[model samples]
Target: MNQLERLRKYTTVVVDSGDIECITRYKPQDATTNPTLILKSVLSKKYDFIVNNAVQYAKKMGGSISQKIQNASDMVSVGFGAEILKYIPGYISTEIDARLSFNTEQCIQKSIKLIDLYRIHGVDVSRVLIKLAATWECIQAAYQLNKLGILCNLTLLFSFAQARACAEANVFLISPFVGRIYDWYKKFCLDSSYDAVTDPGVLAVKKIFKYYKKHMYQTIIMGASFRRIEQILELSGCDRITISPDLLEQLKTQNFSFARKLDATKIVTVVDQPIPLSESEFRFLHNQDAMAVEKLSEGIRQFSCDQIKLEKFLLHTL
Candidate 1:
C-alpha cells in the first residue's frame, strides 16, 4: 500500500482544501476549509461558480453594505463547504469569521447563520462542523451549540489549556495546529535541523492526545496545519488528521511503512490532573506560553486578513 493507504489504517485522513478536484482525488474521509483556502478557491476556475452564485444571492439580500458583505462571506464559506460535502461522506468544517473569534454571542449568532445557509443549500447541520477560534468564550459558545445539537470544531488551538477546555466542553472535535507550532520553534532555534519525534508541534499534539485518552475525554483530536509528512506520520494514530492536498498527494506516492504512534488502549502513565479552564485562568495560562500567545494572535490576524480579502473579491463579483 502507498503511504496514504497505510496512513488510513491508523488515522482518518481529511483533505484540507477548497478545491473539489483535490478532495475528489484523495477521497479523504472529510474536508476542511478556511478563509485562506476559500479565498484561493474563489479565484480558481473550477470553483468560481460558488463565488458567483454567492455574489448574486448577496445582491438580493436585504442588508447594509457591511451586512451584505458579511452575508456574502458566510454564503461563500457555506457554499464551498456544502459543495465539498457532496464529495466526502463525513463532515465538512466551515470556519466562522476570524473577526468574531473573541465574541461569544457573535460567534454563536454567526454559527447559527452559517447553519441556516447550509440548510438553504440542502445540507444538514449534523454534517457540518462550525469552526471557531479556541478562545474561552468560543469554547463556551461551542458548549452551548453542542447542547443544541449543533456540533463544532474548536480550531486555532495551541496550548494545553485550550485543548483541556475544548475537551471539557465536549466539543465535536478540536483542531490542534501542528505545523504552526513547528514554525515558531524552527524560527527560534539556533540550529535548523529538528527531529520529527522531538518536534515541538508533534509533541504538542501527542501531549493533548495522551491527556484526552488518559481522562477518557470523548472529544476528537484532529491534528491540523502539518508542515511536513513526518509530522503527519508521527501523529499517525490521532483521531483524525486534516492534511493539505499537496501533502496528501505526497503521501500517496511514497511506498513506505508507517506505524501508529498514539494508542488509546495503552496504559495511561502520564499525569492526568484536570486543568482549570476558567476565563481568567485560560487567559493567564495562554499569556504565559510565549508560543501559544504569539501564534494564536497571529493565526487570528492572518485569517481575518484573508476573510477581508475574500469579502472584497466577492464584492467585485457582485
Candidate 2:
C-alpha cells in the first residue's frame, strides 16, 4: 500500500484545500478551508462558475455594497464547501472570518450565518464543523455554539493551554498547527537541526495528544499545518490529520511501511488531576509560551489579510 493508504488505517485523513479537483482526486474523509485557500480557488479559472454564481446571488439579495461583498465572500466559501462535500463522506470545515476572532458575539453570529449558508447549499449542519481561531473569545463562542449543537473546530491552536481550554469547553475538535510550531523553533532555537522525532511541532502535538487521552477528554485532536511527509508519518494515529494537497500527493506516490506512533490504548496510567483552567489562568499560561503567542497572532493576521483579499475579489465581481 502507498503511504497514504497506510496512514489512513491509523488516522482520518483530511484534505486541507478548497480546490474541488484536489479534493476529488484524493477523496479524503474530511476537508478544511480557510480564507487563503478560498481566495486561491476563487482566482482559478476553473472555479469561475462558483464565483459568478456567488456574485449573482449577492446581487439578487440587494444589500448595501459592504453587505453584498460579505454575502458574496461567504457564498464563495460555502460554494466550495458544498462542492467538496459531494466527494467526501465526512465533515467539511468552513472557517469564520478571522477578523471576528476577538469578538465573541460576532464570532457566534458569523458562525450561525456560515451554518445558514451551508444549509442553503443543501448541506446538513451535522456534517459541518464551524472553524474559528482559538482566541479566548472565539473559544467561548464555540462553547456556546456547542450547546446549540453546532460543532466547532478551534483552529490556529498552539499552546497546551489553548488545547485544554478547548477540551474544557467541550469543543468538538482542535487543530494544533504542527508546521508553524516547527518553523518558530527552527528560527529561534540555538540548534535548528532535528529529526522528525525531535521536531518541536511534532513534540507539541504529541504532548497534547497524550494529555488529552490521559485526561480522557473527548475533544478530537487533529494535527494540522504539516511541513513535511515525515511530520505526517510521525503523527500517525492522531485522531485526524489535515494535510495539504501537495503533501497528499507525495504520500499517494510513496510506498512505505507505516506504524501507529500514538495510541490512546497504550497511554501509561498516572495520577493526573485535571485542573479546570479559568480565563485568567488560561491567558497567563498561554502568554508564557512565546512560540504559541507569536504563532497564534501571526496566523490570525495572515488569515485576516487573506480574507480581506477574498472580499476585494468578490467586490470586483459585484
Candidate 3:
C-alpha cells in the first residue's frame, strides 16, 4: 500500500485549506483553516470576493484598524467555514485570535460569540471546531466550552507540558505543530539530530501522542504545520494530521512506502487523571510557558496583518 493509504490506518487526514473546491476534490476527512490560509485563498481569482465582502463590511463598521480587522476577520472566516462545510462532513476548524489567548475570560467570551454568530447564520454548530492557541487561557476556555457542548481544536502547541495540560483539561483536540518543531530543531540542532524519521517536530508530536495514549487521555492529538512529506510520513498514526491541499494531492499521486509509526496500544500507559484548571491557575501556567506565549502572540500579529493586507488587496487590486 502507498504511504497515504498506510497513514490512513492510524490518522484521519484533514485538508488544511479554505478552498471548498479543493477540499471537495481531495476528499480529506476534515478541514482546517486559519487567517493565513484563508487570506491566501481569498487572494486567488476564484475566492477574491470574500475579501471584498469583508472590506465592505469593515467599512460599514467604521473604526480603528484593530476593530475593523476583527469585523473583517469574522466576515472572512464565516465565508470560508460555511462554504468549506459543503465539502466535508466532519468539523471545519476556525481559529480565534492568538492575541486573545492570554485572557481566559476574553477567550471564553469570544468563543461563545463566534459560535453564536455561526448559529445565527444558520450554520450547524456540530460541524464546526473552534480553533485556539494551546495557551492555558485558550485551553481553559475550551474546557468550559466543551462542557457547554462546543468543541475546540487547540493549536500552536510545541512542548510536552502544553500537551499534558491540554489533555488534563479535557479539551476536545490538541494540534501539536510538527513543522514548527522541526524548524526549531533545525535552528538549534538539539543533539545534532537530522534524520527524516526522527525530525524534531515529528518527535514532539510522537512524545505528545505517547503521553496522551499512555495516560489514556480522552483529548485527541492532531498534528499540524508540516513542512515536508517526511514529517507527514513520520506521523502516520496520529489521531489526525492537517495537510495543505497541494500536499494532500501530492500524497494521493506520489507512490511511497509508509510505516506505522505510532500505536496507542504499544506505548506504556499512565493513570488517567481528570484535572480541571481554575482561571487563576490557567493564567499562571500559560504565563510560565514561554514558547506558547511567544507563538500565540506572534500568530495573532501575523494573522491580523494578513487581515489588513487582505482587505487592501480586495479593495484595490481585486
User: Considering every candidate listed, which one attains the maximal lDDT?
Assistant: 2
State the lDDT of candidate 3 residue by residue for 1-318, as single tens digits.
666777777789898888778899878889998878887787676876665676677788778776676767777787788778877878889987666767888988878877876775589898888998876777778889998899999988876667877888888888887777666657755585567677877877887887778778889889898888888888888889999876776787877776778888788776755465565766676678555556656666787677566656544522
Model 3 bad stretches (over 4 Å): 49-69, 190-193, 272-297, 311-318
Can you give the lDDT of residue 256 in candidate 3? 73
1 versus 2: better lDDT goes to = 2
Residue 117 CA displacement from its true place in model 3, Å: 2.5
What is the TM-score (0 to 1) of candidate 1? 0.96
Error of 1 at 72 (Å): 1.3
Q: Which ranges of candidate 1 are over 4 A from the true structure?
A: 269-276
**Higher-scoring candidate on TM-score, 1 or 2:** 2
Candidate 1, poorest ten consecutive residues by summed lDDT: 267-276
TM-score of each: 0.96, 0.97, 0.86
Candidates ranked by lDDT: 2, 1, 3
